[model samples]
Target: MTADPIDQALFPPFDDAAGFDRIRADLGAFLPAIRAVCERHGLAASGLAAFERGTNVVVSNDAGQIIKLFPPFLRHQFEAERLALGRVHGNVPVATPEILREGELDGWPYLVMSRLPGRTLEEVWPALGGAERAEALARIGEIMTAAHALPTGGLESLDLGWDAFVERQIAGCEGRHRRMRLPERLIAQIPAYLASARPLLPTSVIPVLLTGEYTPENLLVTQTGGAWRVTGMIDFADACLGPAEYDLLGPCLFLAAGSAELQRAFLVACGTGIADADLTPALSRKLMALALLHRYSNLGYQVRIEGWESQASSLSALEQLIWPFPVR
Candidate 1:
């Protein structure tokens, strides 16, 4: 007998190494659970539907509200998120979702937030030209700097120490990539590559509020004066304290999408100048290692370069594959 699938579950399956295929498969039952939450919280539930994005059981309501229900295992993200919203509201150039309330639901923790405005930059990227893409990238870069420039007052409480986090990531880098199905050719050289790149990660600088994924999907943009501009940044659940450069890898790879010119625009705007020829190689390798070690790194989708597995003979070549230029 197949016990009712959704009824058979105690909580959302742990967001562990296995991932979330089952949740999506049983979304119909999940919707009712969300509706119950909405009913209890007194938030609109008329149009509630699974948001169908990211790792959690996120659902949206008609009243410009989003409710993200995190599994017990991802409770750390819940903590990081509530703190992040309060801190970013008035401090940064853009707006993050305002937390209306937070509490437990059927043993799961959840947050109800006021959704911000503008279409995700990702939804509009394919329609944007080179000049428009460059403009959007540059604006997002400045916003990143502004967010990073703020004093890390209470953010340190995220409790993810940089030294330990980097060491943990460095130690697990090889195993992680192997599981993520990185090609053998590239996987073989990870140890030697990370050894050289280790020194490039800075330990002494004042830590910045490091958002996990800084790509266009998290950035909101609107057409302003006939040019698209970044309006707001969203999704801080996976955020914590880390090096500012750690935040750049996503946008550099996903937003730039293998264009050296765009990569240069963003890196320069973020205040990491690449004009000096000597800095590019070192920067490239450091970012490559971080990309592999990223908490949510998935090279399958993040690596946009086609035929890269066959083309990139070594980690250095793969770095060039992503950065795509010697100097700009």
Candidate 2:
């Protein structure tokens, strides 16, 4: 409708950029623009390289820092991340990014933060042994536990009220899943299943900050005496405030890969014990509803376990399959 203002020689031709495909398709093209932000901030000599993962424009260098950019339409994520990193930095067990500088570039907001060490758990999960995986999940649980315990009295930016958020998600649950091409079997059960699970969810529980970013993608791991450990956590752009269980969906469905032992370890360490009489089944049901309601939920893509589709004949079946746990 109007003229593009960014220097074409530097920034990608992001005109009418509706989806991430354009960015992902030619990520290198945006490096000049990425560097322009650095140049503006006087950190341009650090030699940049693009990280080819996830949505968003990201680049890092050997200067012990990284830069992340959120498109104009996604500026809310930039604000959310900036606030989240500050709130949980020293409070959580694992290391989180420390913001060094932040500013907007031609309508795209960017943050230059202290880069954390260790490979991402997503990069190493497939190779880790049983014990290492267990330990990693356990550590993740601890980080989450500490986060949930932090005071949430006045952080309105992070508090995505669980009630209203869920209401909206429920309203569009069927349509969202349908658009995502979820199987008709699961799609058909959305209404009654969520209604049945409503009694299991909390209406008055103390709200906690929810990052929804604890998956292998965000978790960093390093070896400690031959065992992998979750050393750092990143990507807080999707952070919000909500019921604690809502945060667990990422770890349970993504990193645990539907394993009873690993999922139970994570849930237990997260302070929601999976043992009998500890509300595992009820909690599992609650999380299932959350899995559908998550802002970025795409079950078919996020859940990593093989054969899950075959096992998930219904919503209840899916919950049990992913959260069998120490319930037995």
Top-scoring candidate (TM-score): 2
Best model number under lDDT: 2
Per-candidate RMSD, Å: 4.6, 3.3
lDDT (10s digit) by residue, model 2, range 1-328: 1123566576666556554646753647877777777777778546678787756788887787888888777888888888888889999989999998888767777888998999988888889888878888888888998888877666687777777877888999999999888899999999999999888776765788877788888888888887778889999988888778778888888877768778777777885544435646777788888888888889999878787888889988888877774455
Model 1 lDDT tens row, 3-120: 1223324444435535664564355647766766676778887776776667677777789998887776778888888877777777877777888878776556788888888998
Residue 231, model 1: Cα distance from true site in angstroms: 1.5
Clashing pairs in 2: 160-241
Error of 2 at 52 (Å): 1.5
Q: Which lDDT values do the candidates have, in the order given?
A: 0.77, 0.80
